[model samples]
Target: MSTAAHSLSSNPWKQGAKDALPLLGGYIPVAVSFGLFSVQAGFGVLETILVSAFIYAGASQFLFVAMVVSGAPVWLVIVMTLLINSRHLVYGPNIAPYLQKDVRWLPLMHLLTDQIFALTLTRMPHMTPSDRLRWYVSAGVIAWLSWILGTALGAIAGDELIERWPLISEVLPFALPALFLVMVLPRCTDRRWTITMVMATTTAMLLKLFGFPNIAIPAAAICGALAYYAIQVRPTDKEERS
Candidate 1:
C-alpha cells in the first residue's frame, strides 16, 4: 500500500471506531429499551427518535420521559434533566486536558456521554492532541448513531416485540447498568479509583436507604471525588512539606 493509504488506514479515527465497536453491544439494547419505554409511556415514534437524536443522554432521557408521562411541569422537567446531566460538568474537565486547544468544542461536548467519556479517558492520554480529537469525535459519532438507530428500531417495532415476548420487557431495563459496569469496571484497577468507587457506591446506597434517593448520585459523586483527592493528593503535599 502507498504510504498515504497506509497512514490513512491507521488513523486515529479508525482506531476510535474500532475501540467503540464493543459499545454497540451495550448502547443499542439500552437505546432500544429507552425507545420502547418512551412509546409505552405515550411518546410518538417520531418523538422517541427525536429524543434519542437530540437529548442523546441515556439515563436523563429515561428520566425525561418518565417525568413527562407523569405530567411534570415544563420548568420541573428542565431542571430535573439538567440535574441528572450535571455530571457532565465533571466529565468535561477530566477529558479536556487530552484534546487540542483549537478542536471545536461544541460538537464534541454535545456528543459526550458516560461511555464516550470513559473510553476517551483511558485512551486519549497516550495519543497526540490532534489524534485524540479525531478519535474522540469518531467514537462519539459512532456511539451517537448506534443510539439513534436503536431508538428508531425500537420506536418502530419494539411494542409488538414486547407483546410477543413478554420477557424482553423484563430484561431490557438491566442492559444499561450492565453496559455501564462493563465499561467502568476495568478502570477500577487503580487503587485510588477503586477506593473512590467504593466510597461513591457506599454513599449512594446509604443515601438511597435513607430515602434521599433523589440526591444520591450527585452526593455520592461529590463525596467520592473528595475522598480521591484526599487520598491521592494530601500525602503528596505532606511529603513535599517534609
Candidate 2:
C-alpha cells in the first residue's frame, strides 16, 4: 500500500529507539550516580541493581537511599517512596489514552520514568496508536537498559572514577532537573502554557526561598495545572452560557 505506512510498519520500534537516544545522555550519568550513591549509602551491588530495576524511579530512589542511611524503618521508606513518586499518578493517566488497549501496557507502567513520560507526551500525538505503543516500549527499553548499565558501572567502577574525576560525580546530581527543564521549556510555547509555567515557577521559587523546598514542587504543579484549567474552562463556560 502506502509508502509512509509501509515505512512505519517496517521498523517502528527502531524509530522509537532512535527518538529516545537524546534522553540517554542525561539518564546514564544520573543513574550511574544512583548506583555510586547507593554504594556510598551502604547498599550492596545486587541491592543497587535490583532497586534500579524494580523501583525505576529517579528522585524517589535518592530519597530512599537517604532515608535508609538515616536508619529509617522499612515501612517508612516504602511509604515515603510512594509519596515522592505519587506524581506518577498524574503521569500514568496522561499517557494511558495513547497506549495500547491490551495487557502489555500494564507491565510497561513499571518502566515509566520522567524521561520516558516526557518523550511519550511530546511525540505520541503524532503517532498512530500501534506505532505509539511500539515506540513507547522501544524507547522505554533503551532507557531501562541505560539505567541498568549506568548502575552496574557505578557499582563496579564508581569509586575509581570518583577518585579520578571528582567533578563528574559532583555534577551528576543536577542532571535530572536539567533534563526536565529541557523537556518543559519547549512545551511551554503556547500562551496558556507559558502563563501556567510562569506561575508555577514563581510559586515554587518563592516557596523555596522561604525554606519550603519540599512543598514547593507539588504546590507549583498544582498552581500551574489549576491556572491552566481556569484559563481553559472560563472560555468554555462563557460559550455554554451564551
Candidate 2 residue-wise lDDT at 47: 95
**Predicted model with the maximum lDDT:** 1
**Candidate 2 lowest-lDDT run of ten:** 1-10
198 Cα displacement, candidate 2 (Å) = 2.6
Please provide the root mean square deviation of candidate 2 (C-alpha atoms, Å). Answer: 3.6
Model 1 scores worst on lDDT over the 10 consecutive residues at 1-10
Task: Give the clashing pairs for model 2.
Answer: none
Best of the candidates, TM-score:
1
Question: Model 2, 11-125: lDDT tens per residue?
Answer: 7698778878887788889988999999988999999999898888887787888888999999999887776576676677778887777898888888788778888887776
Tens-digit lDDT track of model 1 for 34-67: 8888998999999999999999988789889999
Runs of candidate 2 exceeding 4 Å displacement:
1-10, 212-216, 233-242
